[model samples]
Target chain A: MHINMKIATKYIVVAILLVGFTSCQKNSRPNYQYMPNMYEPIGYEAYQESDAFANGVEAQLPAEGSIPRGNFMPYEIEDTNEGYELAKASLTNPLDSTQVDFVRGKELYDVYCGICHGNKGNGQGKLVQREKILGVPSYDDAGRAITTGSIYHVIYYGKNTMGSYANQLNEEERWQVTAYVEKLKAELEK
Target chain B: MKHVIYRNLTSRILSLGFIILLTVSTSLSAQEGDVAKGKSLFNANCAACHKLNKPMTGPALANVEQRLIEEEGLDREWINNWIRNSSALIKSGDAYANKIYNEWNQVAMNAFPQLSDQDITDILAYTAAPPPAPVVVDAGADAVVQEPGISNDLILGALAVLFALLALALVLVKRTLNRFAEAKGIDTVIEEKRTPIWKAFIQNQFLVLVTAIFFLLASGYFVYGYFMQVGIDQGYEPVQPIHYSHRIHAGDNAIDCKYCHSSARVSKHSGIPSLNICMNCHKAIGEVAAETQQEGLKEYGVDYNAEIQKLYEAVGWDGTGYTGETQPVKWIRIHNLPDFAYFNHSQHVSVAGLECQTCHGPVEEMEIMYQHSPLTMGWCINCHRETNVKVKDNGYYTKIHEQLSKKYGVEQLTAAQMGGLECGKCHY
Candidate 1:
């Protein structure tokens, strides 16, 4: 009887364990309902390609290889009066702003021009006033009416005592300083 | 027969109790969702369009549940519906839906119909939960505010308590049954006394040798791990001199992250903006709030306060003003990796196209910047191992993909395969 009781107890324990494990495994997943029609209907018909007629007359299409107008230009500089004029007119502003360009011009002037042309742009520059350098012209001199082109050219390929600034000042930078020098000339003349 | 009946009853009852305990514990564990998985999902899906505390394409998702509940009359069902198909709801003349659509400039929200409801729920829960209050970065303050939400430590504590109570009950039942058996003059088979671990070890020569070997192996492994992790500061938070809030700048005002860290895409260093850059806006911006005193300037409206005056002092800009003496703003550096670690911000921000917050954490929510990533070699390698290289429609990767496919015979190449996990890539 005791042996039978022991076997019965063991069976009961095992059954309980099996029940527990199975019950725990019984789809504990939270029920989720997926509704396909909840969102907007997507249209695929708009993407299809359609040709209307299969008649004998073919469409006259442009040749596959044709060069369009105004698409080509040589990337070289020519040294002539006409070329220089075109270059001068074509030369774009290197700095975006007048303020920035002016600031840059002032900085450049201080570095290069201030020794020859005074800070105040008067004839009495440090070199001229100190008598270290001579033949410096006052911007208000009677004979000269400097054009923008002349000023640009003088800055590009310097005249008389001045050397060529082609290497020192880039094309656009020379023009900017020329603008500033013109401002100084006007200030001195005023 | 009586004795048999008694034994069977006792066993059944014991088993039932064990089963009940196990069921309860399992159910409790199921209630808490995985936060790490939620974080990854959030980064992948939501981070591009939305920030936690800042406005992007959508409104800031910080405390999103509360906002939805109060503002939109939304429950969990409504949120799930909106995430799946917002345009459909808008078309159906939902008043709130139309308002949100118009507010966001009619930009179509991406449909996430594939995401399970449980996943959406977990994401919402993460959004609602306030981040752990920042650690008192200063060594002077030892008070660290634990992160808000169901902490693992708390869960473990509760489980421990429950198990302890169950153990006590079991002991009590055993004692009562022993007493009953004794009273009935039953022949109880006494259980053999358990051998003490030390005693057992001393008795068995083989066991002693095995134990020694195990100890040596464990210690060696632990030492190796410790050495590997020495300089890695995964969660390093350093105190800043000033409480400059990225939340205010990047979040509230919607300032572009690149505006301040401009060199992020263009240069090796995500260069700290010079004081001149700050002055560009700050010169006109002045004090954000009237609460702070206006520094530097003497006239109440015209003069700058002491703090702004410091900026003037740095750049040598006298407030008289524009005396042309400008000084640089000396901002303290926050995110510093080792010299050997070659992390190019441009490569990550521009080329790979990672969000700043991936490594920086939720910078928009931070009052002061701190190093969020441990920036360890392992952390980097692990990320490279897991993250797939973004190759779709990128011209740079077009040639690379062809080569990779030929070598691996796979359509996709992971970041690790693309030399991201190379020691030289991160180091040197």
Candidate 2:
């Protein structure tokens, strides 16, 4: 009787464990990591609070006028109408025609500008076409005919109804986008 | 009485004819440039501030010429001057201009010094025309968009139901057979002392051997699987600080994934986007949409508006400039590789041109982000083995392709054939 009881208990335990294993669903909780230190490194995450730091600041701003290595040349134009006028009058692309990669520029443009400005640069993008945003103009329009400097200026310090893309794109990338926009504008005019 | 009725009908008809004639003459005279030309011009200059049917940063410009003339006592010349330079008008202390400026939150209308009188007239003409009816793109898009969320629960439920029915049928059959045996006066029940399970198991060597082997194999397999699960986080979905729906941003709105994950093309990590990136659109779209709010967040079980409030708190944006009291959004990281394993996002994303969804598992459909792939070494090696090196257009691969194709004696070479499995390729 005792042996039978022991066998019965063992089977019951086994059955319960098997049920528990199957019943526990995927995405219920995070499964155990063997060595968490390996999975989650000892390195500090960007913008994460650390015990070593006071006031919980990790990503500190660089000194004013400092530039990262291999980045674009520093843009001097400030975010102002006078600055835009100055850029338009004087600033030409440092990159020549050969330096421009319209393909890369198109890729960047699609990511950033094609939502509001149509893929064809015809001002009928998904946002404008849906009437979510009004008044995006075609590049071919006489009043909206833009130069490289004007495009760069607007990208650097956003114009009316558009926000600054400076944070999202580096200086070189902004130029790439400008080159692409010029291509689109030329195409529309043609 | 009949003669009086006829006279009344005739007078009414004459009045209607006169009104129609007046409308026809005004429309004829009011026509300016080609309406199409006017529309293009309007989109360029006037669209930034004005909507024809609704008010935006500037007043609704429907019947704008009439309104400005009749209501505000401003003529075409005054309107033309205002278009050229509203700032000058406001500075000159024009009461109407100042009032307009003050009403519009003092956002100065940009000067159109380049605009000719004809250009302004064309824009005015476009505005005078009736607003176009909004076009609704097909309902078929939404209907076709939803991929069936297939899971194993359906199969499991069916199996459970089948087993229950089978058990019921078996029990009933057994009882019926026993009663029939008794009715036939056949001795079916032995009524002997039952053998202990262990003893019975021991007696049946074949059964014991099979069960032992199965147990041994199953346990061995289970133990191996458990050990393999060490660094493999297949479904490690942690609750994020805020509920940011990829479905809404990436799926429904068709926002490019790279817009948020900008660094994936250039950097090592598929970097988390900064809060400023979120602000690009969120500044305009402050609240959770009414329809989206109705559908509760299934994964986090959090309210939609409450999530927006959390974002507001993180960015310290009170619908205007920064409030200075800010907290960074600390999203729980889902995919993490070991420190020794080096995975360059640019190498796979930019150079190799693998879609983010290839590794990320249809992120557009994901409401809450989770680790869809196992992120296992085996998974990586398998992909490298199967995937072909795209060598057609890329200049960098041309020389390598010639040599590798010669070496392998094949027309097309896979990633593995090009030394993708070399230890230094990943480990270093």
C-alpha lDDT of residue B420 in model 2? 88
Question: For model 2, what is the error of residue A46's alpha carbon versus the real structure, in angstroms, after optimal superposition?
Answer: 3.9
Question: How much does each candidate deviate from the true structure in C-alpha RMSD?
Answer: 35.8, 7.1
Name the top lDDT candidate.
2
Off by over 4 Å in 1: A1-190, B1-229, B239-243, B290-309, B318-320, B324-330
lDDT digits (tens) for residues B1-428 of candidate 1: 46766778878999999899889987655445455666555654565356677565466787787688897778878777778877678888988888888986665565566668778766766676668684444332212223322476788889999999999999999999989999999967767889888887799999889989999999999889666655544444444333355765676544557656756756677776555555434443344433222211212233234445566666665422346654333344445455546677888887787888898898887655656787766778888888888899788899998998889998888899888877777654
What DockQ results do all the predictions give, each relative to the true complex?
0.01, 0.44
Stretches of candidate 2 off by over 4 Å are A1-29, A51-57, A141-145, B1-200, B287-290, B295-306, B320-325, B392-395, B398-402
lDDT of 1 at B286: 40
- I-RMSD for candidate 1: 31.8
